[model samples]
Target: MDKRLIVVLVVFLFVLWYALRTAQIPPASIQASAEVFYINNETVTIVEKDGWGLFTLEVKPRISGFTFEIEFPEGTEYLIKVNGKEYRGNTTFKTTIDKDSEIYINFRLPDEDTKKLYRGEGQYYLTIKASKLPIWYVEYKIKLIPRKEKD
Candidate 1:
């Protein structure tokens, strides 16, 4: 089996896991029993951030006949937040693991961007506008924790 292909499969699975979580017990309710958000005819799983450390989440959906890209909108600005504040994106994170062993990328975003966070937990949020032309789904993941107190 191709190594790269395997990696992609693993990451896809992880993204799928995170994406489904929102549908399983989403905070808001949807009219359709199987369908949730409509993004380019895809289901985006979104969840509130709760904790820290190697937080991996999946963004792709595992449903059939679904069509959409996990990538964010074209003109949207993305920033990772940790514990309610802007995170230094310089923190090194690799997509290779996300593509292989990880179900989601172990990327650490700042949590200070959100104040409604739960203690001992972290939250990450993605801000973007909905595409009016083709109904689209937005799958967002959140992870929060203190900056690894610089050594």
Candidate 2:
């Protein structure tokens, strides 16, 4: 056997081993889920099942309200629920792909009612239901800290 050929074969084997070792294998379930929680600004990628592409969810927190926006793939429709209740007025908030897949929701926080309901800190649940795909749900906890009064 040629010395150069043996060296080439050894290098190829190492590369193959490295590639396999670093590769990430997704879960086997038909549904996949991811979550991101932030106080101010953040972007989260929602991966679809069966190796489909991902979508982005952008969250922005402001002094008065919190904003949520979702950018989904084409030809997809979705419904959102907050804390086991449907968001806003609609029975089911729906959005289609042909139009903008980005859906936005804004909520005012720390109000008297909200403070009483949350009791300073509590867990909140969010559910995203694709019209065709399986249901996906995420849970987040919020803590309210009292700020010291300026002297």
Candidate 3:
């Protein structure tokens, strides 16, 4: 065997090993459910009108994408937060649902711009707080879907 060929093979194997070891695997789909609670005031126990939901994921270090699908009543006002930070994307996070809409929001995993963003091998939280729901409603749900990185 040629000496140069052996050296090239060894380097290739090392690179492959490193890539495999550092690659991030996308998480599975998650469904989060939430229920309303009560607040005790001085005079009475008030039922909280707001609905809350939480979706948590331990993201790995990688440049991936995610989709959050949320459904609620037409008149509901909602807010979404990621790792305690408010998501400011207007297209993804709608503050109010004036009309009926099928919401689909996309975000990057292991965010590269901000270290504090959802871009590390740690537990990340995605929370939703909605208000002005129908009086009969008492539960809320949110779904998280992982998407593969495009080539």
Candidate 4:
């Protein structure tokens, strides 16, 4: 091969390598206001005929893997949803005050899926429902951690 052609090829390869090495992926951005929600002694009654008791709370979560601790008076069936999406339980029930970290009455989203909540600032609804009646003193504590980015 000609010397000029060889030099040009080497230069091109070097430039390409430099460009690729220096390139950085932009960090994911979120307009989120981290917050914590607490529900103390809220009344919830589920008639035996209806078979379900329900309530909703508003919160803003900026990051994933948050802890949602809940508590109730007795053993009752219940379900919880965040913006219409069901929260997974640590064991049998996701949110038991209608659900705690210590006694395992907590709920949370996986790392991959929680981005939907951190996209922007808006009203995020957390709905808790019980399958039957008579467990009063429903308490819920939802702690949302703020996302910190490097400047």
Candidate 5:
């Protein structure tokens, strides 16, 4: 190759390297304050049900991965739309209490998906859309390690 051509190629390579290096993802975010949800009363059930402990919601998931809990006024109803799809779990339970006697309708998915609440294993972005508006959007970037038993 000619000397001038070699210099131009080196400059192009340097520029390309710089651009790629700067194309990094923003820094990880801070874990916000305890998550509480306020949903339109029309669609959420924030009440106690059956004989369950604080029925409304419960997800103290097993497997040390991640825990997400949401507390809202009683009489709140929510649909579990995980990653834009419906999931099968206690997430469909109804809240039968009023705000005056309010308790949390919490949902916990332990270990990302130790039990496969919604999506498969590994990192995930869980979103909660209340009523007709997009409310309480959350992302849980977690690693789902397999559970083991020790004898």
Candidate 6:
């Protein structure tokens, strides 16, 4: 075989191998349970059913806050608890299930003075209690990346 042809073939094979290796699905950090579906390394959705109907809970971490999206049967009631405290404040919002019913909980990096008290990066737990549905719970891992300062 010609030298140039051989070189091109080898390069093409390496590229193909790299693509296949990286395209593989990431192993689930949390195994699938009775009601929880581990979507990926950073997302999980919980599905439960009761007399009221089907309900779903999706949890994902964002740069500054955590996105808590949920879908419950109409007229159903639910409560959210963050780190053991009831989250019944302005940060929570109510919307229809057909729409993107998302509740964003904003958090900030602890400043130098308050770093010891509220060290920003770590895992946070959330417990959601829904009417006529099994209690849904999840732990969200958060990592804070510093923003680049623009000149």
User: Of the candidates shown, which would achieve the greatest lDDT relative to the real structure?
Assistant: 4
> If both were scored by TM-score, which would come out higher, candidate 5 or candidate 6?
6
Off by over 4 Å in 2: 1-92, 108-113, 133-151
Per-residue alpha-carbon lDDT of candidate 3 for residues 104-139, written as tens digits (9 for 90 to 100) = 233332322223222332322233433331211122
Writing each residue's lDDT as its tens digit, candidate 6 over 88-136 gives 3222233222222233333222233123223333322223322111222
Best by TM-score: 2
Model 3: lDDT to the true structure: 0.33
Off by over 4 Å in 1: 1-52, 58-102, 108-133, 141-143, 147-151
TM-score of each: 0.22, 0.26, 0.25, 0.26, 0.20, 0.23
* Candidate 5, superposed: residue stretches over 4 Å from native: 25-151
Identify the runs in model 4 with alpha carbons over 4 angstroms from their true place: 1-51, 61-65, 87-151
lDDT score at residue 52, model 5, on the 0-100 scale: 18
The true-versus-predicted C-alpha distance at residue 131 of model 2, in Å, is 3.8
| TM-score ranking, high to low | 2, 4, 3, 6, 1, 5
Lowest-sum lDDT 10-residue window in model 4: 25-34
lDDT of 5 by residue, 75-136 (tens): 32334432233333443332221112222323343332434422233332223221211122
RMSD of each: 18.4, 15.4, 20.3, 19.7, 15.9, 17.9
Model 6 backbone overlap count: 0
lDDT of 1 by residue, 68-140 (tens): 2223212222343322334333333212111111132223233443223434443333322111112333433
What lDDT would each prediction earn against the true structure?
A: 0.32, 0.33, 0.33, 0.35, 0.31, 0.32
Residue pairs with backbone atoms closer than 3 Å in model 2 (clashes): none
Better of 4 and 5 by TM-score: 4
* TM-score: the better of candidates 2 and 3: 2
